[model samples]
Target: MTETARPAYKRVLLKISGEALMGDQGYGLHPPTVQRIAKEIKIVQAMGVEICMVIGGGNIFRGLAGSAQGMERTTADYMGMLATVMNALAMQSALEGVGVFTRVISAIRMDEVAEPYIRRRAVRHLEKGRVCIFAAGTGNPYFTTDTAATLRASEMSCQAIFMGKNGVDGVYDKDPKTNPDAKRYDAVSFDEVLRKNLRVMDASAIALARDNKLPIIVFSLDEPGGFRGILSGQGTYTTVSG
Candidate 1:
């Protein structure tokens, strides 16, 4: 087999699960976790790659968690969305602390805190090498940040979506945590993922990616410097495309 190093993508969407922001305590934002993530991103930024980010709110509140406890679905979802905004702000501050230019754009408008989500403005930010942090989960209930990642990727014309996962490296035939013998796939088609009910992202997010012909790369976020390694084609990851 001929081996050739993969080229760095010109622009990319980075989807970070909220659980990643939770450190050893297993709750809320961990400053060190955010700082480490930001540092990895700084390495990629220095490589001349444009980036856009979407951070989930699982660390603070997940709609499913709230709904399962008897809360109204819409209210729970909104709270979950707000939680993502909080995560975005935390990330923005961390990135800026390292001298990386970043802008937090929210699906829900809060003029005092962040810019309202506008596809044009976001694209402009990326073109200028300014990282854009998308928050608030599409500004609508019943939508996960996974879906928002796909939307932003398409909107910004990103070459691929990088899913920064915690613990597990990639999608598996079964829950890796529960089944130690679960088979891991290095590469797979989106259709196969849906056919087998893989829990990488929700169906809506997967469908959007498939429709747009965007490749999704899943990798470990907990690994120090893993984000930069993925961009440099030296990290463990799974690619889903075509």
Candidate 2:
């Protein structure tokens, strides 16, 4: 890798599952894991790239899981949104620890904790070189964080959305963990992803990204420098677009 490599995109959104923060633990955040990921983002930001982030709340509470357990769907979803906020704060603390300025912007208003999601304000923050962590899943109960990430990336005019997976390196035809023969594609189409139910993201997210003609780069978050490597155009990952 180059000592100081240039990033491919001027601006991008990083979407990771809440479980990525859990590290080796069964649930919740692992401080070391969070810090490690923060350092990766710091490396990219140092290359003069603007970043937006959306972290899912599966580590704390999954709205769908809660609903499946007989809880009210909307209420459970709101609870899940709050979980994302907690994860965002944890990430914000880690990023700041590495000397990267960050702002936790929430779709739902929570001025005491995070700034309310105002499009102009969030874009300004990115223009000023701040990593904006978008929390609270679109402020809507039915939407998943995947859809929220796509929406935010589109609104922010991000060049692409990077879906950082924990163990899997890229989008596979089947769950690699379950099926060893699962094939990985260097690049796949949005229509195919939706057709096969590839599970890279939700249907809504995939459709929205397709409609906007935005690219989604899926890579391994577990690799030490995977995120930065991608920004530098030195990584192996799958691209889902058009």
Candidate 3:
């Protein structure tokens, strides 16, 4: 990475699944993996790109999983939201450890731990070069963190949303893990993704992004320097747009 190699985007929202923070662990956050990802964000920040992050809670508690086990739907979903808050704090600590300024803003307020999500406040933080970690998944049950990411991206007027996946590099024609012959797309239209029921994001989230003309860059977080490489236009990733 060179100082003169400018990025195509000035600001972006990074959507990372809770599973991405788990590394090889079956559940919960892995300190080393979280630190590595924080370094990736720090590198991007050094490039002068403003960032907003939304992390999922599947590593700690998945709403659907809880519901499947007979827990009340709303109750399970709230548990998932709390899990995201925990992940956000962990990420905040890691990013701060590397000297990157961050603000953990939550949709569901717990004033003692995280600041409440206020659009104007978050924008101000970005203006000052601080990464805003949006947590608690819209503060509503049923909506995934993907929707929260899209919502925050739009609210923040981000150039795009960078979705860092754990295993797969990009959107595939089939499950790459299950099918060796699966093909990955370099770029795909939002409608194509929805029509094919691809797993880029949930239908509501995709539709929200499509309606707002927000592009989503899906890439592998497991690859070293992958996030920074993609921003510099040097990596393999899928761009989902209109």
Candidate 4:
């Protein structure tokens, strides 16, 4: 393989917001976009890398948003968890459509639709070259999907967590969409992300990754071939480490 086609990781966990699946729509899954992401995952898997995925449910429901509108926090959070399961199923269909084997594992017990989250089974699925999509936000309230992604990545022993974003390509000092002068970092330390309050991931997730010494690569999901390109060491992205 050429240098540009060589992937840098043996295994990784991809974390994306449900908003990423919505495309230009205000909310809900956009089938074309979902298929596009699945194809990206397929490219990486073709390179022989184990894959785990965690997709946020912000497009369909957000517990914090529900709470802000006067719903009970825990109930809203559980509702949000269910939303993630929906997203997971959508992604599973897309991945399967592309001929990439996938498993939708839920943290909540919903055996009819998805398999319950079991670390060993999930790891075994990855070992067998199937993509594992973790859903249901750690099966608890008060914790964001970011935390769930970090927790799952740690448990799966992923080499890195790829934070697939929409719009902007990498972590910036300011909101790039709002500020034309926003500067994107080539690399940033986890401490700097916390001290600067940069929006790489949640504080808890960042802390967990830092504690475990796992690197995070922040990149745009909208860029065609972007995820695979990054793994091949040929993309514009910010690496968070040390």
lDDT of each: 0.91, 0.95, 0.95, 0.94
- Which candidate comes out best when scored by TM-score? 3
Q: Write the per-residue lDDT of candidate 4 for residues 79-132, one digit (tens) a residue.
A: 999999999999999999999999999999999999998899999999999999
User: What's the CA RMSD of model 4 in angstroms?
Assistant: 1.2
In candidate 3, where is summed lDDT lowest over 10 consecutive residues?
A: 1-10
Scored by lDDT, model 2 comes in at 0.95
Clash counts per candidate, in order, are 0, 0, 0, 0
> Better model by TM-score, 1 or 4?
4
For candidate 1, the per-residue lDDT at 16 reads: 93
Model 1, 84-169: lDDT tens per residue?
99999999999999999999999999999999998888889988889999999899999989999999899899999999888988
- Clash list (residue pairs), candidate 4: none
Q: Given candidate 3, what's the lDDT at residue 2?
A: 84
TM-score of each prediction? 0.96, 0.98, 0.99, 0.98
Lowest-scoring 10 consecutive residues by lDDT in candidate 2? 1-10
Candidate 3's residue-wise lDDT over 1-242, tens digit each? 68778988999999999999999989999999999999999999999899999999999999989999999999999999999999999999999999999999999979999999989999999999999999999999989999989999999999999999988899999999999999999999999999999999999999999999999999999999999999888988999999
TM value for model 3: 0.99
Q: Rank the candidates by lDDT, best first.
A: 3, 2, 4, 1
RMSD to the true structure for each prediction, in A, is 2.7, 0.8, 0.6, 1.2
- Looking at model 1, the pairs that clash are none
